[model samples]
Target: MKKYPKYKSSGISWLGDIPEHWEVRRNKYIFQERNEKSVKGTEELLTVSQYTGITKRKDKVLGENKLLTNASSLEGYKTVHKNDLVINIMLAWNGSLGISPYHGITSPAYSVFSIRNKNENFSNFFHYTFRTKIYHSIFKTVSTGVIDSRLRLYPDDFFKLTTLLPPLQEQIQIARFLDWKVGQINKFIKTKKHILELLKEQKQVIINDVVTGKIDVRTGKPYPKYKASAVEWLGDIPEEWEVLPIKRLSKAVKTGSTPPGADDKYYSSEGINWFTPGDFSDETELRNSKRQLSALGVSAVNIFPPKTVYMNGIGSIGKVGICLDSASCNQQINAIITNEKISPYYLLYCIKSAKQFIISFGKFTTLPIINQEETKSLIFPVPSKDGQKVIVSYIQEKTEATDRAISRIEREIELIKEYKERLIADVVTGILAIRGVEVPEVIEDIEEELPEDEPEEIENKEGVE
Candidate 1:
């Protein structure tokens, strides 16, 4: 990357200086605010997102649904046209503004603007500019609200903000350069993400094989003999293994309850660990939680002893973790206190293997939930205490390498993403000169990394579960 031949300050402190040939103008001079509304309630509804630009509401693939009511009239809804910039007032600081590629209607709460400049290339240039970290900071300064999420960037305030504009021809070159460069970076990221997914899947397969006795860990070979378990999902297990209901193997199985709301006396920062499904992770043991309970809160709830296996019975069903210390949980979790017949670590693996089956028993409503009785009735394969210890040790040893590899790949992906963002910001803001620069040859040959000796014919199983 190279800098321009000469530079001059734009008089805006955040902008610093730009190429001498470029011009600075307020947004009002470059864009005309559009407030036209659709009379009919029907129009192709569109949504604005921070990840994706303006897209059909039905085409949104991420985030929760916020459109709760069906309005009888869309006369109050704003009409948006292709190439028009749409800003979600409340989320503009978070990069929820973008140039629309579709003609539609959006919530009246949003503001719409159309480029007034005739060059046509300015739209693409500004698209990248507005999404830069610099502009996001500027938006935060101008926005008004008590909290970040509630902040609004009104049309009046937006138009008053200063903008830097490159020459019409230079704007086109920069946009075209970025489109190619960013696309290559994104492809590299996608490849890394796929590799991370494969590592995780391999770990899961190893766990399943050891827990079900499909493979003997000590010998690293499949069992020669097997017997039908009669349970469909469990399929077949080693002849020596026995399947039993969870209730029979556990001394107690129960769910906790939340105390009354808004009671400060019952909540404290330095109390017993209060576990939630969100606190559960890939780790087998949980030593801490996002929120802790007060002594009063623990007294009002059941505090299970250390080593108790906890499974989410509601919402994120099947996530399991073992308490490293005495902990209390909300009503959404079911804790199992196993007897000497079962190893808590082994039970955790068994429940994890039967995740889909446990989820099937849940009642799907606004939130899915499995009652204590249903959880207790679920069947689990129990091996002798000695066998349980061996299986747990085998899984830990086999998965440690895979876990490290996955963590490394994940960290690499984050670094790559950060680089991509910085590159875009530098190029779009005129801090780096894209003109006359040749695209790197390495960008074209970036290949997806895969495990050694894996069959290319196998379908690429990508993404973490």
Candidate 2:
């Protein structure tokens, strides 16, 4: 990275300093808010997202898009043209704003802006600059709101903010440099992400095999005597294994309740380990939650003892976690206190192995939910208590290395993303200059190398099934 020939103080605390040649201009002088609406509102719909920028609504396949059905006509929707910036005013503080590459209509609640000087190549420069955390922080400070999601970067206040305007040619060079550098970084990240996914899938297969008795973990061999599992998804199990419904194996299957939200006395910084599905990753133990419950809150809910397994019965269904200590969960979760016949760890693994089947019983309406009856009726393959212990221990030993590898790769991806963000901020702010720099030809057409499909059944070379 190289610096500019001269420097000057930006005066703005967020933007420390910039190249002396850069001009400090109010946004109003650089951009004009556009309010044009589609007469028919039939143009391709578009959306602004923190990750993807402005993309056609049809192209956003990862998440559900809420459509306005009550609108008698599309005439009220705002029109956005190419090169225009669309800001989801309420979500601007979260970086849900971007430059549009397609002509389309968006929700009327959004704010649209067009560069005032089209010849200046400022659109690309501003696109990167505005998305920086520094700019988002500024947006949050100026926006009128009590909380982040409610913050609104209105046209009046947005235009009042100052921006650093580098020379036209310099802005183009910086943008081009970033386009190449970020592409290279993203390629590396994609590769690591694919590896992480395969590792997780591999771990899931191991859990499925050991818990179902498909593999005898102690001897690293397939069970000699097997019988039909009766369930289609669960092919076969050891002849001695029993297939029983969850209701038969648990002393009690109960759901917890939330304390009254208006009562602040029920919440605390430290107390019982109150958990939600969001608090723990799948198959992990629940040690802590984002929100803890006071003694009163715990008393109001059903508090299960340690080693009890919690499964999310609604919303994100089938995510299983073991309670590390006595804990209470919200109504969305179902806690099972196992009987003497079943090991809690064994039951947890069985639930994880049959996750997809359990999830299939969920009724999808406004949200996905599995009623208590459905949860209790779900059957699983169960081995003897001693056998269950062996299986659980085997799974822990087998997947330890895979889990560590996944965590390391995930951390690497995070570092790469952080570096990408810093690189963009520094380049666009003129802290780093790309003057006469030669970008590699490989960067011009860099594409992510996708990981090969992982085998559904991973074979152990040492003869473990």
Candidate 3:
């Protein structure tokens, strides 16, 4: 049984100050990250293995659409030999860092490091050390904002963090043992992720069956029908339904533009919503956002009263939602005014359904943006005013139920992951000390080389070496 310190931080606290001889340091200073690199784009390019450290980029490609490839032909791209560490600066926040154990070239997104020293105890020891949850938690907590996600730790910061270094012999044993253990955990996590994907497909199947009048098949057949008119997205509709451009159906299509200059104070976190493409999450009510901008501050910008359906026209464009209350949008989003002809709720649902396809049509360099005309062109099956209400209410109830169920499952998975991290920390650190393990040393300096293994006398200690 593993023994933990008696001073108790509850179930497990794997960490404590190391021996006086050891030290905590940032990783960047101990090893220099290579730059001025380009992908040769050829000769067995390497890519991050979603499950492990390194794999042939093409080997992992599966299924119908292989949109992303790690193919390389250019020779200039840097090569990473076995035992090198690589971390994607952008995706690092998402736990994208891994040790490379195969011959491969990483994308420029990764900061490749060559281990300078070869202390057997600390070489791969540091690599596994970084995988500890406590270490990465420290890395992620400091990062925030758009660029915060891209925070890259240089060697200085990296080497500064303290390490609880085990003795040389134990280091090798622990590294090899935990390496296998981590691989198993990773496989388990991947299985959970795959199961989640299947659940989503199953849920979509449920939606298709019920929403398209497939479920309750016999009685749902003769539900209702409307005639074909010039519907926005769907050309023909029920005979009794009205087909009209959104322009005719609502107040003018008003696009919000930002005022020329404003201080950050104008965008207060506590005021009315100052929405942008990023602020929108739900496709339902555009309601006030978690983020707000002061009315006086946004006065120079295009502000729209709430209760209007909002569509993002900028990057991540075409997400449609209804505003919960009075709010203003930046130029990239359009605050739409709808008239009595179409129920706002119904229109929001139609837009929400079409948004994915509409967003696919967005065209722009950096920011994929959609024009008002394209948005208005989205077509849908129109029911009579009364039918519109029925369909809207029905779809809302169903979709929200699906969203809640999915969210609950996602939360449970997150908690499982947290528990898993705690387990790893307890094992890796001394808190849940494995039997026969000695107290750890906090590494202070990167060492240069490992001592040679001593020769042993002949003995039948084991059947295998």
Candidate 4:
């Protein structure tokens, strides 16, 4: 083993400078692949996972391998030796790759390659590097033809990828450093995620208190004041407040059409956003659409101006967003065009908080529907316009502040999650090895899942480990 200096630079380029004694080589020059077929097998089966790496062979996870009755003579499945790297080349883009340190049997879908190199640097380094962003880029960038979503990487492309090498001693060292650094970043990210969860809980608490009248907006207090004169959803709203149906309140109920898509020239990357379910998923509200349409697209569909109250229906029923600018939604949405006594912000808060209620009365077996009449018949709590103004103003200031803080923390948490994923990827791949790392042993998931039936009868299964 040799002592290597800690050199700093951007990206993975600095990874190339290994200890002076190491041999460097492309993957193609070092290994030959044996493509195996599926026959009767008794190997504890394994399957490739994108979010998670390869997992232990269970009944259906290898899918339909149960028909074989042979005690131990299955020969079609290829054998993987401990510490040999195995990847599902098809799902590699999604990071469905892992190292099998315990020699095991896996599904024929996986292309199991054993590094034939007798050199010590090979095993110590190959597992880690294959999962790195640097190596993945090398493999993906040069592949010809449209890569099939389901097809595993061919031997040709798999063999041609660029590789970074280090002396046997440094391979171990780099892996160790990556392990330590990623663990630190992961801890920071976990802390931020916990804080975000706490903030969300606090936000929900405030919303429940105020909305449910547990906290009186009038007295600026809670739990003491009660009123007998109340409506169903608006039960016991402050006496001064008015309960009204949505039909009399709004100006018009309008829906949008799908934008024209035949003309590619009309739509460009620079056009204004076209709001869709993708835009509002997970409560994310910003101005970016997967597909942008032009003026024709806008005309073909009704274009909503900024500040429109957009609520989703069908597919993602009751999901709501206040459009920040002019945009159109598919026919699945109802954009209310109203201004009188309507605080878009207040309406937004009300609708978002009441989405479950909105969908509660909806009817359908395969698909649910919230009727326009039902939407118009929605009962709401209305304080004085002056009170509405005050509350809306208060909510704006408070929520904007909360949203900004939450956004910042959430972004940090995301970066941390990436770091954690990268850390795991690095460790499992052997690019950076962390010895004796603690895996949260008490995974509650396995115990909670109630499978519909015994899993022995299925073919091609996807599971979370």
Give each model's whole-structure lDDT. Answer: 0.78, 0.78, 0.55, 0.57
On the 0 to 100 scale, the lDDT of residue 421 in model 4 is: 59
- Count of backbone clashes for each model? 0, 0, 50, 8
lDDT of 4 by residue, 150-174 (tens): 3446667778764555555556655
Model 3 Cα shift for residue 288 (angstroms): 8.6
What is the total number of backbone clashes in candidate 1? 0
Better of 1 and 4 by TM-score: 1
Worst 10 residues of 3 by lDDT: 454-463
Question: Residue-wise lDDT of candidate 2 within 222-307, one digit each (tens)?
Answer: 98899998987788889999999989999989887888652657779998877876675633677878878898887787788989
lDDT of 3 by residue, 198-237 (tens): 7656545543443232233234553365444543345444
lDDT of 2 at 232: 79
Cα lDDT of model 1 by residue, 1-465, tens digit: 788899999888999998888888899999999989988848887776665557676542212422312444566688998889998887788787788878989888888999997664468788778988889889989998765645789988999999888888888778667767777877888788778778867888888888888888768887778898888888898888899988888999989777666266777888898887668766788878987889888888899999999998865678899987998887878999998889999999998888878877777633456888998898887778898999999888888998788778878877987997899898877888987876554435332232221111011110000
lDDT score of model 2? 0.78
- Candidate 2 residue pairs in backbone clash: none
Model 1 whole-model lDDT (C-alpha atoms): 0.78
Error of 2 at 189 (Å): 0.6
Candidate 3 regions exceeding 4 Å error are: 1-16, 19-30, 35-40, 43-77, 88-96, 106-110, 118-164, 168-219, 223-236, 244-304, 308-323, 327-339, 363-373, 397-404, 424-430, 434-465
TM-scores for all predictions: 0.70, 0.80, 0.63, 0.58
